[model samples]
Target: MDADATARLLCVGDIDMDLIVRVPAPPSRDGKVDGRRIAQTPGGMAANVAVAARRLGTRTRLLGAVGDDALGREALAALTSEGLDLSHVATRHGEATFFCVILVDDEGEKSLVKVMSPAFLPRADEIMAAAFAGVAHVHLTVARADPGLAVAAMARAAGATLSLDLEAADLPADLPQGGGALADLLASVDLLFVSDRSRAAVEPVLGPLTSEGRAVITTRGRQGAMLERSGTRTQIPGHRVPVTDTSGAGDAFAGAFLSAMLDGADDATALCRANAAAALSTRAYGAQAGAPTAAEMAAFLDVDGVRDA
Candidate 1:
């Protein structure tokens, strides 16, 4: 199924203001060191994916929340600038917006500390079914189970294809254990973008997926991604390039893969495009700043869409 101009995609998750600081290396054992502070940038798993897909010329929509405060306004303004449909994004009157402190080392590897509030997540009951009208696809970032279930049910009802980016780092403290929560959510999507870091926790539940005709994917930094379907695995090589900040490369991969799928590209072709997009995204700082446009992506690969090697 190819997505045309009228095709719509919905992204659901948290939106945040990121404070990135460049440090020589992680401070050791209470060691104090000075670092250069980068300017605040608006990004979050769901929001970043939305921006990436939107950059590739998809008509995208974002469903999440932010505060009415200045920082929240700044973040919302960023999404608005991307031309994403923010009609379902809520504005909490008195609460503070979620934010993250990302520390990047010389090698562009990062460690982040996020300050999130359950209050910032959208509730399932508050969502109107009418909000999803005309949406052809739904991609969910890590969120509370109930809301994920709600969205999944609606997507099924609307006959929309569903996918999820279940990054291990984003899993809440309580939900990462056992095969229960992950398995429950896994049942909702036909495609999952899991991290290699999550394989240990994610593997046990994956057995059922392949048997059910679902696919599970794992993204490896600078090593491209691997896709598993029907118990068969395909390793797609990554594009190597000069690295700057690796912050949003994976999100770029997820977004680009979804965009390619919308364009009717096969899995291997989509992953090659996604790898190229992720590599290009590391050319600059911040997650969304370095994301390449469709033209940029096409030029880099020197081909519009090449099939697997």
Candidate 2:
């Protein structure tokens, strides 16, 4: 791969340990049910996306905060094993690492319960202009306001395309009491990732985000995904795969699609690549385990009549 063609990504967001349990159904009130299986893995929107990009042969850097605890060490080790640049990952004291409990039902539906640790200090002063050199894209999960805004500003000033995962539910509590802040953020983002669940909250503020130049990509789980751009909408068909857990499928799709775009792929081709990755990610129990390599992606896409658009 040509180094210049593909972007060196900078992913700024959250990291957590995910405890995934497979259950037959929600337990009856005051009742107990046995879980089919349990798996503990690294999971967080921003961290998952960075790992996905790296697995697909993109140079990626992950910047986030974690506590100085056992879970934090484990999460850091997991990310380091994936070969992501973690020089920017901050370690804070007096707090435990964040984590989530994910329950997956028989139908592959997931319900997440997250616990956030104390906020880490802002790293805006550490963000140097030189850090963006040769970086083609900056991806953010706006779980907190300060860091996200700082990174967005730096990415823009460095001439890199800016992307955001609208983690609306996790936005900082201190943000101005209105949707105005969100609307302003949406106006400048080049690519936006919104889950089907978040589309309602986002659309009411920004209206339909698709326009002549900006693009808003929505992930609809098994229904595939839609790319809205240039006043047009393109349906990227979903691939059928044996579902294990749907924990990080959307994050995988976002990372793969952005990496493809940085490599100069057309919208259709990028979406195809992303969809293939997301589909393949469901074949395993954990988010990172199912992330496909470039070779795996090619093989998956080569089967049957599948072809790049």
Candidate 3:
């Protein structure tokens, strides 16, 4: 497995307008303070991962929705410049696009508030099994479980590897506690990315997925990441970098890790590459702005003494 012009990878989920504001500290309710800066950028779990993978020279595509509004147009333009295939993306009429307000504090920690549009719940007619044809890998930033199941079924028929990011899913609120339909959908994936904060809540339902022959990578912010697979687990220490905003670091890690694995990198090598990419992503303010290209990533790895594993 290697990335080339024909390496078809698809990311399915949200695409939003991210309004990022930098503040000295977390704001209190009904209290306001002058912000250092504010900027609008394209963001969303699937969109960010698609951009990250594109930065690594993978042939990536996005399958999601946005409103037929200016914000949606802006996001489309940004993704287009990044070279992601948007043929399957939908434009919903009479609806506002999804938007998120991200507040970054002095420590680069963030708090986000999101507004989702009706378009976020894609219509059944919009999903087509043929879309998965020839795809080598399919990643879902699952906000809705049903669509993910639909896509996974298609991916399975196409013989593509399936991957998932759990943060996008509305978890405990939407799924049954004792491992229901949602758990079944998650179990079908080849790779799973979970944040440390959500680990405890999720572990009970998913159990040790790696022990079942699936790869699970846990993202632990500044502490780096850990990979568990084939009954073995390894901790990949995070790199120390000048942190600006940690908004898209996890997305960077997921995308880079998937691309590395597709490129035939071994477990340790892939985890190291992912950590390097994620640490480098924190050098800038917005999620997509700081992502490095393949060559840039190679140089970063060399400088950081993580050339390959």
Q: State which candidate has the highest TM-score.
A: 3
Off by over 4 Å in 1: 1-7, 172-178, 204-211, 303-309
For 41-97, candidate 2 gives per-residue lDDT tens digits of 998888899999999988998777788898989999999888888777778777788
Task: Predict model 1's lDDT versus the native.
Answer: 0.80
Considering summed lDDT, which 10 consecutive residues are worst modelled in model 1? Answer: 202-211
lDDT of 3 by residue, 222-279 (tens): 7989988877888888888999999889999988988888788898888988998898
Candidate 2 ranges with C-alpha deviation above 4 Å: 1-7, 28-32, 119-130, 171-178
| Root mean square deviation (Cα) for candidate 1 | 3.2
Better of 1 and 2 by TM-score: 1
Across residues 78-165, which tens digit of lDDT does each residue of candidate 1 receive?
9888888887888888888988888889998888888976545677765667657788889888734768888888888988888987
The pairs that clash in candidate 1 are: none
The residue pairs in collision within model 2 are none
State residue 64's C-alpha deviation in candidate 3, in Å: 0.5
> Model 3 Cα displacement at 299 (Å)?
1.4
Clashing pairs in 3: none
Clash totals in order: 0, 0, 0
